[model samples]
Target chain A: MKKKENKIITDDIMIEVEKISMRFNLGIEKGFSLKQGFINLFNIKKRKELKAKRKKNVFWALKNVSFKVNRGEVVGFIGANGAGKSTLLKVVAGVMKPTEGNVDVYGNICPMIELGAGFDPQLTARENIYLNGAVMGYSKNLIDLKFEEIVEFSELREFLDVPVQNFSSGMVARLAFSIATIVDPEILIVDEILSVGDIAFQAKSEKKMMNMIGGGTTVLYVSHSLAAIKKICTKVIWLEKGKIKMVGGTEVCDKYLKYMEGK
Target chain B: MINNLKYVYAKYSFLLKQLVERDFKVKYKRSILGIFWSLLYPVLMMAVMAIVFSNVFKFSTPGVSYLTYLLIGLTYFSYFSEASNLAMSSVVANFSLINKVYMPKYIFPLSKCIFVGINFLLTLIPLYIIIIATGTGLNWAHLFLPYSFICLFLFTVGMGFILSTIAVFIRDMFYIYGIIITIWTYLTPIMYDIKIISNSTLQFLMKLNPLYQIINFARSIILYHNVPTLGQWAGCGVSGLVIFIIGIIVFKKNQDKFIYYV
Candidate 1:
């Protein structure tokens, strides 16, 4: 058996976000007309000499967010809708870049942010497993080795050869969860995906997550379930209106829950 | 450059496989002939054009029949045109995957190009049968077809990358692409031989269009049984390398902003 590495907190923060912010423009302007367009076209001689300045009209999705996650810590990011939880997770996963600050992450990240985003509807479940595994950065040999285990975990043995588009949402969720956990990444970032499966699948997913955490993997979990957050997370960060509201232990959940209820 | 290639291949190999299979399967799923449709469309187009243009124009294509000449040129041109059309919407078509996953964004465009390349390869079987059945002697230069295809593939990938990235930001790109492609086709010498242009100014303009050189290279080997000029090959090599590099730079720079635009 491969021995698990113990966590030593000697200035080894696994992930850091410093004043990270993301901005996006939301509206459109009037189109240029033929009269103004013709003048502007003739004015291109001057426009070529003068570099056109970019307009500044954009909204910030995340604002002045700063946090550090140490090794082997299970942190929950709880936020209301449009609170930038997904954006923050995407930035950490290296999918999206923050407009204002720097985000640094160490170690491999398996972001289960959008479960089965790479799935082809026409492809069979067996084919999708390999395709999904590869998309998640696993090699073909690695997928081959873990193929049986993933199929068993997904509980889709009979339907393995069936097209994924034919499968139910729960089945897809199960398959996605199984593929994600098969990799045993050093850092796992999950976003609101665990709530889709049934009670049994949820229990199985929780067990897998606990096992991953027990093996000293750092986790950043984003979900609306306060009960799940309280059960699984040791550290909590509450976000409201694209800003961090509070950071503390499970007790902060009570405050956040009250804030949500008060709204 | 090699490192970038490795990275792209590593990041996109899965998606490319899936898209290639999807491209082949989806087109043939309900049709009785399946993938034969890929060949049928081009063959039918070539036949119609050959008959229509052979009577109208009296230019002679040395060392090959007019049908053979037209088929070779049309086959190469169709690949380029179809690749650009597919690439125009590749990013938008895969918006769900692009918005969620962290892989190289160029994969969507490049995979679409590769999908069309596979279709081109499948379509070549009919071309080959026609060449043999028509008794056109297969020379040693025919073996260099793969190398020419690699050049064409690089060129298509470069163009696809640029167009797909632009399409993400520009809402009107989809509507404008067909008109652009129609104009580009006339600029290319697919129906007429490059030698037919007598004026020096028109020939210079034709040479400036990069697709002209690629199509000429393909037709020279396949139909004329002659190798492309040193200058033409050099133009293809230099342009392919430069465009590919530019495509990668543009794709990497703009990839982060795609989610916002989409």
Candidate 2:
């Protein structure tokens, strides 16, 4: 009965995650040499030792995670570090496929997953804008259309030719935020972008996000700030150690907050 | 596969351009010589080889000047090594983007090929000037330049894709590839002549190396001043296509798994 509904999408379902799981194999690595590698491959006792190590290497980053994202909904993901927020986000973005189950997204997704995700520090601010825009899936013509607006918003008029490596951290953050938000993609996946730069810039960035939401774009956001999540997100998914502990409205936030206080 | 390709290209074609440009910019930054180094490098190597091979060993070119003969080989071999080495590291080097961003993994290796191809372009004018300077007459066979280049370019990009994928799984690939490329360079008869080899079996093995086939293919047009035989043309196309097709399939299969490893 449940298997029958797995593939179908009714109205208002923009993204659907069904029992997605991710497993990471982690291990200690000795320094690499061809001779050492070949020896490790053949040694019987060493093979058994390696097998034991492999057992210890298994890390379940996400386990049986299921959710649904409706159209034009701003869903917030709140979790502690290593709670699989980014992992789950990557699976939904189709950057990484899940080990089990699947995610169905019915919209064009533009992920601002990490600030300056494709920027070369050695390249100038102007260069990075074009590069980042391309990474955001904007064509060269589209970038040309929005290049001046990005520069104006960044307010680095004097430093257009200066390499981004030389820019201040806050200044770099401004440039990154400006490029990510310049064009509103259909389904925006934002990860902690609002916490960057100075206070005024944060406010300005929040306002830009509000404008995108107003334009009927769906968003899946990951952030550590509960107050900010409550202010912007209509629904919240609280992840705890690779599991969806609770899912609801601000009540989920209240329960998550209470649980955090208890912990 | 066609639909998938169209989607990725439509989405990230501009990103691919910026990435290639970024590589060149980073490569030449803070260097006084800048891109002249691209031209200077092969020429300087040829000069050193001419002294040792021509003056010391007195190696012979059958009809063409030894300078032009060695320069063509050096130019092509350098392009092969540079493109492969950069591409081998393409996936691992872009670890930050692989995990954080959503661009296709193939773009990483493809960008390396594009970057090296740009540097290869800098080698041509100097090559043409030398060909004219050494009294090597330009012929209609030179029209095959674009054909030879496309074959070589496909071959390099294919190798890059395969190497970058393997490097993701095995860290030792970094060292293993160096040894492999060195052995490959020596076996290809780049600095030495094919006529010097006496063993038919060893000679046959040398012919199997695609770079050997590609270099001679270019040399046929440039120095030999003749169009390649249909058989030679088929050899270049088949080898390049087979390698490129295999590379794309392997890369696509493992691309999703890469996020975990990278």
The best candidate in terms of DockQ: 2
- Residue range B111-230, candidate 1, lDDT tens digits: 788888988998788788788877775888988678668878888888888888889888678878889988988778877777788999989988877777777777778777887778
Q: Docking quality tier of candidate 2?
A: medium
What DockQ, on C-alphas, does every prediction get? 0.37, 0.66
How many residue pairs clash in each candidate at the backbone level?
Answer: 0, 0
Tens digit per residue, CA lDDT, model 2, B102-180: 6678888898998999889889877888899999879998888788788888988999999999998887899999999
Query: For every model shown, what is its TM-score relative to the native structure?
Result: 0.88, 0.92
Q: In candidate 1, list every pair of residues with a backbone clash.
A: none
State the weakest 10-residue window (summed lDDT) of model 1 chain B: B21-30
Q: Which stretches of candidate 2 lie over 4 Å from their true place?
A: A1-10, A28-50, B1-7
